[model samples]
Target: MVKRTALYVTLVAGAFVSVFPYLLVALTALKTPRQLSGTEPWEPGLPPTFANLDRVMHSGFAGYLGNTLLMTAALTAGQLVFTTFAAYAFARLRFRGRDVLFWLYVATMMVPSAVTMIPLFLIMRELHLVNTWWGLLAPYLLGTPYGIFLMRQFFRALPAGLEDAARIDGAGPLTILLRIVLPLSRPALGTLAIITVISSWNNFMWPLIITSGDDTRVVTVGIAGLKGSIGVDPNQMTAAALIALVPMVAVFVAFQRYIVRSVVLTGLK
Candidate 1:
Protein backbone atom coordinates (compact mmCIF):
# COMPACT_ATOMS: atom_id res chain seq x y z
CA MET A 1 0.00 0.00 0.00
CA VAL A 2 2.77 2.44 0.90
CA LYS A 3 4.83 1.73 -2.24
CA ARG A 4 1.80 2.04 -4.53
CA THR A 5 0.89 5.36 -2.89
CA ALA A 6 4.43 6.60 -3.39
CA LEU A 7 4.35 5.58 -7.05
CA TYR A 8 1.11 7.45 -7.69
CA VAL A 9 2.45 10.52 -5.97
CA THR A 10 5.62 10.40 -8.06
CA LEU A 11 3.64 10.04 -11.29
CA VAL A 12 1.36 12.93 -10.43
CA ALA A 13 4.34 15.11 -9.60
CA GLY A 14 6.05 14.18 -12.87
CA ALA A 15 2.94 14.93 -14.90
CA PHE A 16 2.59 18.33 -13.21
CA VAL A 17 6.23 19.16 -13.87
CA SER A 18 5.87 18.22 -17.52
CA VAL A 19 2.62 20.12 -18.08
CA PHE A 20 3.32 23.30 -16.07
CA PRO A 21 5.28 25.12 -18.80
CA TYR A 22 2.63 24.49 -21.45
CA LEU A 23 -0.09 25.53 -19.01
CA LEU A 24 1.82 28.75 -18.30
CA VAL A 25 2.15 29.39 -22.02
CA ALA A 26 -1.59 28.89 -22.49
CA LEU A 27 -2.38 31.32 -19.71
CA THR A 28 0.10 33.86 -21.08
CA ALA A 29 -1.48 33.63 -24.52
CA LEU A 30 -4.84 34.60 -23.05
CA LYS A 31 -3.55 37.66 -21.20
CA THR A 32 -3.45 41.28 -22.28
CA PRO A 33 -0.31 43.33 -21.76
CA ARG A 34 -1.62 44.83 -18.49
CA GLN A 35 -2.63 41.39 -17.26
CA LEU A 36 0.72 39.97 -18.33
CA SER A 37 2.63 42.65 -16.43
CA GLY A 38 0.44 42.54 -13.33
CA THR A 39 1.55 40.96 -10.04
CA GLU A 40 -0.78 38.02 -10.69
CA PRO A 41 0.54 37.66 -14.25
CA TRP A 42 0.15 33.91 -14.36
CA GLU A 43 -3.53 34.02 -13.35
CA PRO A 44 -6.15 33.42 -16.02
CA GLY A 45 -8.26 36.37 -17.03
CA LEU A 46 -12.02 36.45 -16.38
CA PRO A 47 -12.52 36.25 -20.11
CA PRO A 48 -9.42 35.38 -22.13
CA THR A 49 -8.36 37.64 -24.96
CA PHE A 50 -8.01 36.51 -28.62
CA ALA A 51 -6.02 39.51 -29.79
CA ASN A 52 -2.76 37.59 -29.76
CA LEU A 53 -4.24 34.79 -31.87
CA ASP A 54 -5.76 37.27 -34.28
CA ARG A 55 -2.47 39.08 -34.67
CA VAL A 56 -0.55 35.86 -35.24
CA MET A 57 -3.01 34.64 -37.88
CA HIS A 58 -2.51 37.83 -39.88
CA SER A 59 1.28 37.89 -39.40
CA GLY A 60 2.22 35.27 -42.07
CA PHE A 61 2.06 32.48 -39.49
CA ALA A 62 -0.66 30.81 -41.54
CA GLY A 63 1.73 30.46 -44.45
CA TYR A 64 4.39 29.01 -42.20
CA LEU A 65 1.88 26.55 -40.85
CA GLY A 66 0.97 25.47 -44.34
CA ASN A 67 4.59 24.96 -45.29
CA THR A 68 5.20 22.93 -42.15
CA LEU A 69 2.20 20.74 -42.87
CA LEU A 70 3.24 20.08 -46.45
CA MET A 71 6.86 19.42 -45.54
CA THR A 72 5.97 17.16 -42.66
CA ALA A 73 3.53 15.14 -44.76
CA ALA A 74 5.95 14.66 -47.63
CA LEU A 75 8.86 13.88 -45.33
CA THR A 76 6.87 11.36 -43.35
CA ALA A 77 5.53 9.58 -46.41
CA GLY A 78 8.90 9.38 -48.11
CA GLN A 79 10.60 8.13 -44.96
CA LEU A 80 7.99 5.42 -44.49
CA VAL A 81 8.47 4.13 -48.03
CA PHE A 82 12.25 4.21 -48.04
CA THR A 83 12.80 2.96 -44.51
CA THR A 84 10.31 0.12 -44.98
CA PHE A 85 12.10 -1.22 -48.02
CA ALA A 86 15.61 -0.69 -46.70
CA ALA A 87 14.83 -2.15 -43.34
CA TYR A 88 13.12 -5.15 -44.92
CA ALA A 89 16.13 -5.81 -47.10
CA PHE A 90 18.47 -5.52 -44.16
CA ALA A 91 16.34 -7.66 -41.93
CA ARG A 92 15.55 -10.50 -44.38
CA LEU A 93 17.81 -10.44 -47.44
CA ARG A 94 21.05 -12.40 -47.38
CA PHE A 95 23.22 -10.30 -49.63
CA ARG A 96 26.98 -10.49 -49.11
CA GLY A 97 28.46 -7.87 -46.81
CA ARG A 98 24.92 -6.89 -45.75
CA ASP A 99 25.66 -6.93 -42.04
CA VAL A 100 28.87 -4.99 -42.60
CA LEU A 101 27.07 -2.33 -44.62
CA PHE A 102 24.18 -2.01 -42.15
CA TRP A 103 26.53 -1.59 -39.22
CA LEU A 104 28.51 1.03 -41.16
CA TYR A 105 25.33 3.01 -41.87
CA VAL A 106 24.11 2.71 -38.28
CA ALA A 107 27.49 3.93 -37.07
CA THR A 108 26.78 7.30 -38.68
CA MET A 109 23.97 7.82 -36.19
CA MET A 110 26.58 8.43 -33.50
CA VAL A 111 27.63 11.69 -35.19
CA PRO A 112 25.67 14.72 -34.07
CA SER A 113 23.61 16.76 -36.57
CA ALA A 114 25.56 19.90 -35.60
CA VAL A 115 28.76 18.37 -36.95
CA THR A 116 27.20 17.86 -40.41
CA MET A 117 25.13 21.05 -40.64
CA ILE A 118 27.75 23.19 -42.37
CA PRO A 119 28.65 20.46 -44.84
CA LEU A 120 25.02 19.86 -45.73
CA PHE A 121 24.42 23.58 -46.20
CA LEU A 122 27.42 23.86 -48.51
CA ILE A 123 26.24 20.90 -50.56
CA MET A 124 22.80 22.43 -50.92
CA ARG A 125 24.37 25.68 -52.03
CA GLU A 126 26.48 23.89 -54.62
CA LEU A 127 23.45 22.12 -56.01
CA HIS A 128 21.57 25.45 -56.15
CA LEU A 129 18.94 23.90 -53.92
CA VAL A 130 19.19 26.62 -51.29
CA ASN A 131 16.09 28.82 -50.91
CA THR A 132 13.92 26.31 -52.76
CA TRP A 133 11.31 23.70 -51.78
CA TRP A 134 13.71 21.02 -52.96
CA GLY A 135 16.34 22.33 -50.54
CA LEU A 136 13.84 22.23 -47.69
CA LEU A 137 12.87 18.62 -48.33
CA ALA A 138 15.94 17.11 -49.93
CA PRO A 139 18.05 16.41 -46.85
CA TYR A 140 15.49 14.31 -45.01
CA LEU A 141 13.07 13.01 -47.65
CA LEU A 142 15.38 10.11 -48.48
CA GLY A 143 15.02 8.99 -44.83
CA THR A 144 17.52 8.75 -42.00
CA PRO A 145 19.91 6.14 -40.66
CA TYR A 146 17.90 6.15 -37.47
CA GLY A 147 14.63 5.50 -39.30
CA ILE A 148 16.13 2.57 -41.19
CA PHE A 149 17.58 1.18 -37.98
CA LEU A 150 14.28 1.53 -36.14
CA MET A 151 12.26 -0.21 -38.84
CA ARG A 152 14.89 -2.92 -39.12
CA GLN A 153 14.66 -3.68 -35.43
CA PHE A 154 10.89 -4.11 -35.64
CA PHE A 155 11.17 -6.13 -38.86
CA ARG A 156 13.64 -8.51 -37.29
CA ALA A 157 11.26 -8.98 -34.37
CA LEU A 158 8.58 -10.44 -36.66
CA PRO A 159 8.11 -14.23 -36.72
CA ALA A 160 10.21 -15.87 -39.45
CA GLY A 161 7.93 -18.92 -39.76
CA LEU A 162 5.26 -16.89 -41.52
CA GLU A 163 7.76 -15.54 -44.03
CA ASP A 164 9.14 -19.03 -44.63
CA ALA A 165 5.65 -20.39 -45.23
CA ALA A 166 4.94 -17.64 -47.73
CA ARG A 167 8.18 -18.44 -49.56
CA ILE A 168 7.32 -22.17 -49.80
CA ASP A 169 4.09 -21.19 -51.58
CA GLY A 170 6.24 -19.60 -54.31
CA ALA A 171 5.87 -15.99 -53.11
CA GLY A 172 8.73 -13.80 -54.27
CA PRO A 173 10.62 -11.47 -51.92
CA LEU A 174 8.67 -8.33 -52.88
CA THR A 175 5.37 -10.19 -52.77
CA ILE A 176 6.09 -11.59 -49.32
CA LEU A 177 7.21 -8.22 -48.05
CA LEU A 178 4.14 -6.44 -49.36
CA ARG A 179 1.51 -9.06 -48.53
CA ILE A 180 2.87 -10.60 -45.35
CA VAL A 181 5.45 -8.59 -43.46
CA LEU A 182 4.05 -5.06 -43.91
CA PRO A 183 0.57 -5.87 -42.64
CA LEU A 184 2.06 -7.09 -39.40
CA SER A 185 4.16 -3.96 -38.94
CA ARG A 186 1.41 -1.41 -38.49
CA PRO A 187 2.52 -0.42 -35.02
CA ALA A 188 6.12 0.20 -36.02
CA LEU A 189 5.03 2.04 -39.15
CA GLY A 190 2.67 4.24 -37.19
CA THR A 191 5.36 5.00 -34.64
CA LEU A 192 7.81 5.93 -37.41
CA ALA A 193 5.27 8.10 -39.21
CA ILE A 194 4.50 10.02 -36.03
CA ILE A 195 8.17 10.43 -35.20
CA THR A 196 8.91 11.68 -38.71
CA VAL A 197 5.99 14.11 -38.65
CA ILE A 198 7.03 15.54 -35.29
CA SER A 199 10.69 15.77 -36.26
CA SER A 200 9.99 17.44 -39.61
CA TRP A 201 7.41 19.77 -38.10
CA ASN A 202 9.77 21.02 -35.40
CA ASN A 203 12.91 21.12 -37.54
CA PHE A 204 14.51 24.55 -37.12
CA MET A 205 18.22 24.82 -37.86
CA TRP A 206 18.19 23.20 -41.29
CA PRO A 207 15.17 25.17 -42.45
CA LEU A 208 16.52 28.38 -40.92
CA ILE A 209 19.90 28.18 -42.63
CA ILE A 210 18.82 26.66 -45.97
CA THR A 211 16.05 29.12 -46.70
CA SER A 212 16.70 32.85 -46.84
CA GLY A 213 13.11 34.14 -46.91
CA ASP A 214 9.59 33.52 -45.67
CA ASP A 215 8.67 31.67 -48.86
CA THR A 216 10.22 28.50 -47.51
CA ARG A 217 10.03 29.11 -43.77
CA VAL A 218 8.43 26.44 -41.52
CA VAL A 219 6.52 26.91 -38.26
CA THR A 220 9.55 26.62 -36.00
CA VAL A 221 11.47 29.31 -37.87
CA GLY A 222 8.35 31.47 -38.07
CA ILE A 223 7.84 31.18 -34.31
CA ALA A 224 11.40 32.34 -33.74
CA GLY A 225 10.75 35.36 -35.96
CA LEU A 226 7.88 36.41 -33.70
CA LYS A 227 10.43 38.32 -31.61
CA GLY A 228 10.71 42.06 -32.19
CA SER A 229 13.73 44.31 -32.41
CA ILE A 230 12.94 46.21 -29.23
CA GLY A 231 11.42 43.47 -27.06
CA VAL A 232 9.29 40.35 -27.17
CA ASP A 233 5.58 40.35 -26.39
CA PRO A 234 4.75 37.61 -23.90
CA ASN A 235 1.23 37.19 -25.25
CA GLN A 236 2.01 37.05 -28.97
CA MET A 237 5.06 34.78 -28.61
CA THR A 238 3.21 32.38 -26.38
CA ALA A 239 0.22 32.49 -28.71
CA ALA A 240 2.40 31.57 -31.65
CA ALA A 241 3.99 28.80 -29.61
CA LEU A 242 0.58 27.47 -28.58
CA ILE A 243 -0.56 27.44 -32.18
CA ALA A 244 2.54 25.49 -33.20
CA LEU A 245 2.06 23.01 -30.38
CA VAL A 246 -1.54 22.02 -31.22
CA PRO A 247 -0.86 19.79 -34.23
CA MET A 248 1.74 17.76 -32.34
CA VAL A 249 -0.66 17.25 -29.47
CA ALA A 250 -3.32 16.08 -31.88
CA VAL A 251 -0.87 13.65 -33.52
CA PHE A 252 0.08 12.14 -30.18
CA VAL A 253 -3.55 11.72 -29.20
CA ALA A 254 -4.38 10.02 -32.48
CA PHE A 255 -1.43 7.61 -32.69
CA GLN A 256 -0.60 7.18 -29.02
CA ARG A 257 -1.68 3.52 -29.05
CA TYR A 258 0.78 2.72 -31.82
CA ILE A 259 3.58 4.34 -29.86
CA VAL A 260 2.71 2.30 -26.79
CA ARG A 261 2.51 -0.92 -28.81
CA SER A 262 5.83 -0.29 -30.53
CA VAL A 263 7.56 0.33 -27.22
CA VAL A 264 6.13 -2.87 -25.83
CA LEU A 265 6.95 -5.04 -28.86
CA THR A 266 10.21 -3.70 -30.20
CA GLY A 267 13.86 -4.60 -29.26
CA LEU A 268 13.02 -8.02 -27.85
CA LYS A 269 13.26 -10.27 -30.93
Candidate 2:
Protein backbone atom coordinates (compact mmCIF):
# COMPACT_ATOMS: atom_id res chain seq x y z
CA MET A 1 0.00 0.00 0.00
CA VAL A 2 2.81 2.39 0.85
CA LYS A 3 4.69 1.61 -2.36
CA ARG A 4 1.58 2.20 -4.50
CA THR A 5 0.94 5.47 -2.67
CA ALA A 6 4.53 6.52 -3.25
CA LEU A 7 4.21 5.71 -6.96
CA TYR A 8 1.07 7.81 -7.32
CA VAL A 9 2.65 10.71 -5.45
CA THR A 10 5.77 10.50 -7.63
CA LEU A 11 3.66 10.51 -10.81
CA VAL A 12 1.68 13.51 -9.65
CA ALA A 13 4.87 15.35 -8.77
CA GLY A 14 6.36 14.54 -12.16
CA ALA A 15 3.26 15.74 -13.96
CA PHE A 16 3.28 19.00 -12.02
CA VAL A 17 6.97 19.52 -12.72
CA SER A 18 6.48 18.93 -16.43
CA VAL A 19 3.37 21.03 -16.80
CA PHE A 20 4.13 24.01 -14.55
CA PRO A 21 6.50 25.90 -16.87
CA TYR A 22 3.99 25.86 -19.73
CA LEU A 23 1.19 26.80 -17.36
CA LEU A 24 3.26 29.81 -16.29
CA VAL A 25 3.86 30.77 -19.89
CA ALA A 26 0.17 30.52 -20.72
CA LEU A 27 -0.63 32.69 -17.74
CA THR A 28 1.95 35.23 -18.85
CA ALA A 29 0.18 35.44 -22.20
CA LEU A 30 -2.95 36.51 -20.41
CA LYS A 31 -1.17 39.36 -18.60
CA THR A 32 -1.78 43.03 -19.30
CA PRO A 33 1.22 44.97 -20.61
CA ARG A 34 1.39 46.73 -17.22
CA GLN A 35 1.61 43.38 -15.42
CA LEU A 36 4.43 42.21 -17.71
CA SER A 37 6.47 45.43 -17.06
CA GLY A 38 7.72 43.95 -13.81
CA THR A 39 10.42 41.29 -13.40
CA GLU A 40 10.13 37.50 -12.97
CA PRO A 41 8.55 35.49 -15.80
CA TRP A 42 7.46 32.76 -13.36
CA GLU A 43 4.85 35.04 -11.83
CA PRO A 44 1.34 33.95 -12.74
CA GLY A 45 -0.21 37.01 -14.29
CA LEU A 46 -3.63 36.71 -12.74
CA PRO A 47 -6.95 38.21 -13.96
CA PRO A 48 -6.05 37.37 -17.54
CA THR A 49 -6.64 39.59 -20.56
CA PHE A 50 -7.60 38.48 -24.10
CA ALA A 51 -6.25 41.64 -25.77
CA ASN A 52 -2.88 40.01 -26.54
CA LEU A 53 -4.60 37.15 -28.30
CA ASP A 54 -6.62 39.60 -30.36
CA ARG A 55 -3.44 41.51 -31.22
CA VAL A 56 -1.52 38.38 -32.29
CA MET A 57 -4.33 37.02 -34.42
CA HIS A 58 -4.33 40.22 -36.47
CA SER A 59 -0.54 40.11 -36.86
CA GLY A 60 -0.37 37.62 -39.75
CA PHE A 61 -0.74 34.72 -37.34
CA ALA A 62 -3.51 33.07 -39.32
CA GLY A 63 -1.46 32.99 -42.53
CA TYR A 64 1.60 31.73 -40.66
CA LEU A 65 -0.52 29.09 -38.98
CA GLY A 66 -2.03 27.97 -42.27
CA ASN A 67 1.39 27.65 -43.87
CA THR A 68 2.66 25.55 -40.96
CA LEU A 69 -0.31 23.21 -41.10
CA LEU A 70 -0.03 22.79 -44.86
CA MET A 71 3.69 22.09 -44.73
CA THR A 72 3.32 19.75 -41.77
CA ALA A 73 0.59 17.78 -43.51
CA ALA A 74 2.72 17.35 -46.63
CA LEU A 75 5.83 16.44 -44.68
CA THR A 76 4.01 13.92 -42.50
CA ALA A 77 2.36 12.20 -45.45
CA GLY A 78 5.62 11.98 -47.37
CA GLN A 79 7.54 10.71 -44.37
CA LEU A 80 4.98 8.02 -43.58
CA VAL A 81 4.81 6.78 -47.15
CA PHE A 82 8.55 6.57 -47.66
CA THR A 83 9.48 5.42 -44.18
CA THR A 84 6.79 2.73 -44.08
CA PHE A 85 8.07 1.19 -47.28
CA ALA A 86 11.73 1.49 -46.32
CA ALA A 87 11.06 0.07 -42.86
CA TYR A 88 9.17 -2.88 -44.27
CA ALA A 89 12.05 -3.74 -46.58
CA PHE A 90 14.53 -3.50 -43.73
CA ALA A 91 12.41 -5.38 -41.20
CA ARG A 92 10.97 -8.14 -43.35
CA LEU A 93 12.79 -8.51 -46.63
CA ARG A 94 15.74 -10.78 -47.38
CA PHE A 95 18.55 -9.26 -49.35
CA ARG A 96 22.31 -9.26 -49.49
CA GLY A 97 23.93 -6.74 -47.09
CA ARG A 98 20.51 -5.54 -45.89
CA ASP A 99 21.38 -5.49 -42.19
CA VAL A 100 24.74 -3.90 -42.81
CA LEU A 101 23.22 -1.26 -45.05
CA PHE A 102 20.49 -0.43 -42.56
CA TRP A 103 22.96 -0.03 -39.71
CA LEU A 104 25.25 2.09 -41.86
CA TYR A 105 22.32 4.32 -42.77
CA VAL A 106 21.20 4.58 -39.15
CA ALA A 107 24.72 5.55 -38.08
CA THR A 108 24.20 8.78 -39.99
CA MET A 109 21.59 9.72 -37.39
CA MET A 110 24.36 10.02 -34.84
CA VAL A 111 25.91 12.76 -36.98
CA PRO A 112 24.50 16.21 -36.25
CA SER A 113 22.16 17.44 -39.00
CA ALA A 114 23.75 20.90 -38.67
CA VAL A 115 26.85 19.51 -40.34
CA THR A 116 24.93 18.76 -43.55
CA MET A 117 23.04 22.05 -43.87
CA ILE A 118 25.64 23.73 -46.07
CA PRO A 119 25.76 20.86 -48.52
CA LEU A 120 21.99 20.60 -48.63
CA PHE A 121 21.70 24.31 -49.25
CA LEU A 122 24.11 24.02 -52.15
CA ILE A 123 22.14 21.14 -53.62
CA MET A 124 18.92 23.10 -53.34
CA ARG A 125 20.55 26.06 -55.05
CA GLU A 126 21.72 23.89 -57.92
CA LEU A 127 18.28 22.41 -58.29
CA HIS A 128 16.71 25.89 -58.34
CA LEU A 129 14.61 24.85 -55.35
CA VAL A 130 15.87 27.57 -53.03
CA ASN A 131 13.27 29.74 -51.28
CA THR A 132 10.55 27.39 -52.40
CA TRP A 133 8.45 24.74 -50.67
CA TRP A 134 10.43 22.15 -52.62
CA GLY A 135 13.63 23.34 -50.98
CA LEU A 136 11.92 23.54 -47.59
CA LEU A 137 10.86 19.90 -47.88
CA ALA A 138 13.67 18.34 -49.93
CA PRO A 139 15.72 16.95 -47.08
CA TYR A 140 12.75 15.70 -45.08
CA LEU A 141 10.40 14.35 -47.74
CA LEU A 142 12.31 11.07 -47.99
CA GLY A 143 12.01 10.76 -44.19
CA THR A 144 14.92 10.10 -41.83
CA PRO A 145 16.90 7.16 -40.55
CA TYR A 146 15.20 7.66 -37.20
CA GLY A 147 11.75 7.19 -38.73
CA ILE A 148 12.95 4.12 -40.60
CA PHE A 149 14.51 2.76 -37.42
CA LEU A 150 11.33 3.34 -35.42
CA MET A 151 9.01 1.70 -37.93
CA ARG A 152 11.45 -1.14 -38.48
CA GLN A 153 11.41 -1.92 -34.79
CA PHE A 154 7.63 -2.03 -34.78
CA PHE A 155 7.53 -4.14 -37.93
CA ARG A 156 10.09 -6.56 -36.52
CA ALA A 157 7.95 -7.06 -33.45
CA LEU A 158 4.92 -8.12 -35.51
CA PRO A 159 3.96 -11.81 -35.69
CA ALA A 160 5.58 -13.75 -38.54
CA GLY A 161 2.54 -16.04 -38.69
CA LEU A 162 0.48 -13.17 -40.07
CA GLU A 163 2.78 -12.75 -43.02
CA ASP A 164 3.01 -16.49 -43.48
CA ALA A 165 -0.74 -16.80 -43.57
CA ALA A 166 -0.96 -14.03 -46.17
CA ARG A 167 1.65 -15.77 -48.30
CA ILE A 168 -0.12 -19.12 -48.05
CA ASP A 169 -3.24 -17.43 -49.33
CA GLY A 170 -1.23 -16.37 -52.45
CA ALA A 171 -0.73 -12.76 -51.42
CA GLY A 172 2.17 -11.02 -53.10
CA PRO A 173 4.74 -8.96 -51.21
CA LEU A 174 2.96 -5.71 -51.95
CA THR A 175 -0.41 -7.17 -51.05
CA ILE A 176 0.84 -8.61 -47.77
CA LEU A 177 2.60 -5.41 -46.81
CA LEU A 178 -0.25 -3.11 -47.76
CA ARG A 179 -3.28 -5.21 -46.78
CA ILE A 180 -1.85 -6.89 -43.68
CA VAL A 181 1.25 -5.25 -42.22
CA LEU A 182 0.09 -1.66 -42.56
CA PRO A 183 -3.39 -2.28 -41.13
CA LEU A 184 -1.89 -3.80 -38.00
CA SER A 185 0.66 -1.00 -37.63
CA ARG A 186 -1.79 1.78 -36.73
CA PRO A 187 -0.17 2.48 -33.36
CA ALA A 188 3.29 2.84 -34.80
CA LEU A 189 2.03 4.76 -37.82
CA GLY A 190 0.08 7.17 -35.66
CA THR A 191 3.13 7.78 -33.53
CA LEU A 192 5.23 8.41 -36.65
CA ALA A 193 2.66 10.79 -38.15
CA ILE A 194 2.36 12.80 -34.97
CA ILE A 195 6.13 13.01 -34.62
CA THR A 196 6.53 14.07 -38.22
CA VAL A 197 3.84 16.75 -37.95
CA ILE A 198 5.24 18.22 -34.76
CA SER A 199 8.82 18.19 -35.99
CA SER A 200 7.93 19.73 -39.32
CA TRP A 201 5.65 22.31 -37.79
CA ASN A 202 8.22 23.40 -35.22
CA ASN A 203 11.13 23.40 -37.61
CA PHE A 204 12.65 26.86 -37.55
CA MET A 205 16.25 27.09 -38.69
CA TRP A 206 15.80 25.24 -41.95
CA PRO A 207 12.69 27.18 -42.88
CA LEU A 208 14.30 30.45 -41.86
CA ILE A 209 17.33 29.81 -44.02
CA ILE A 210 15.64 28.21 -47.01
CA THR A 211 12.43 30.17 -47.34
CA SER A 212 11.75 33.80 -48.22
CA GLY A 213 8.71 36.07 -48.62
CA ASP A 214 5.37 36.16 -46.77
CA ASP A 215 4.06 33.14 -48.70
CA THR A 216 6.84 30.84 -47.56
CA ARG A 217 7.29 31.73 -43.90
CA VAL A 218 5.93 29.13 -41.42
CA VAL A 219 4.61 29.65 -37.89
CA THR A 220 7.92 29.17 -36.07
CA VAL A 221 9.66 31.75 -38.22
CA GLY A 222 6.69 34.03 -37.98
CA ILE A 223 6.65 33.72 -34.19
CA ALA A 224 10.33 34.54 -34.00
CA GLY A 225 9.76 37.67 -36.05
CA LEU A 226 7.09 38.87 -33.63
CA LYS A 227 9.57 41.22 -31.98
CA GLY A 228 12.64 43.24 -32.97
CA SER A 229 14.02 46.76 -32.43
CA ILE A 230 10.81 47.73 -30.66
CA GLY A 231 11.75 45.13 -28.05
CA VAL A 232 9.78 42.05 -26.98
CA ASP A 233 6.37 42.40 -25.39
CA PRO A 234 5.79 39.66 -22.86
CA ASN A 235 2.08 39.49 -23.56
CA GLN A 236 2.46 39.40 -27.34
CA MET A 237 5.32 36.91 -27.35
CA THR A 238 3.61 34.61 -24.88
CA ALA A 239 0.34 34.88 -26.75
CA ALA A 240 2.05 33.89 -30.00
CA ALA A 241 3.85 31.06 -28.26
CA LEU A 242 0.55 29.82 -26.93
CA ILE A 243 -0.92 29.99 -30.42
CA ALA A 244 2.01 28.00 -31.82
CA LEU A 245 1.60 25.40 -29.09
CA VAL A 246 -2.08 24.68 -29.81
CA PRO A 247 -1.61 22.43 -32.86
CA MET A 248 1.01 20.28 -31.18
CA VAL A 249 -1.18 19.83 -28.12
CA ALA A 250 -4.17 18.90 -30.28
CA VAL A 251 -2.10 16.39 -32.28
CA PHE A 252 -0.74 14.76 -29.14
CA VAL A 253 -4.20 14.54 -27.63
CA ALA A 254 -5.52 12.93 -30.81
CA PHE A 255 -2.74 10.37 -31.09
CA GLN A 256 -1.89 9.84 -27.42
CA ARG A 257 -3.58 6.44 -27.32
CA TYR A 258 -1.51 5.17 -30.25
CA ILE A 259 1.64 6.66 -28.74
CA VAL A 260 0.92 4.88 -25.45
CA ARG A 261 0.13 1.65 -27.28
CA SER A 262 3.34 1.83 -29.29
CA VAL A 263 5.41 2.39 -26.18
CA VAL A 264 3.75 -0.44 -24.28
CA LEU A 265 3.93 -2.95 -27.14
CA THR A 266 7.39 -1.98 -28.33
CA GLY A 267 8.86 -1.96 -24.82
CA LEU A 268 7.66 -5.50 -24.20
CA LYS A 269 9.65 -6.76 -27.15
What is the C-alpha local distance difference test score of each model?
A: 0.89, 0.87
Please write out the lDDT profile of model 1 over residues 1-269, one tens digit for every residue: 99999999999999999998988989999888888877375589657899999999899999999999999999999999988999999999999999999999999989999899999999999999999999899989987898898889988888999999999999999999999999998878988998888889889999999987888899899888888999888889999999999889898888888667656654564
Show how many residue pairs clash in every candidate, following the order shown: 0, 0
Residue-level lDDT of model 2, residues 129-228, one tens digit each, is 9889899988999989988988999999999999999899999889999999999998789888877887898899899889887788898898889887
Candidate 2: stretches off by over 4 Å: 1-10, 38-46, 261-268
User: How close is every model to the real structure, measured as TM-score?
Assistant: 0.95, 0.90
User: Best by lDDT, which number?
Assistant: 1
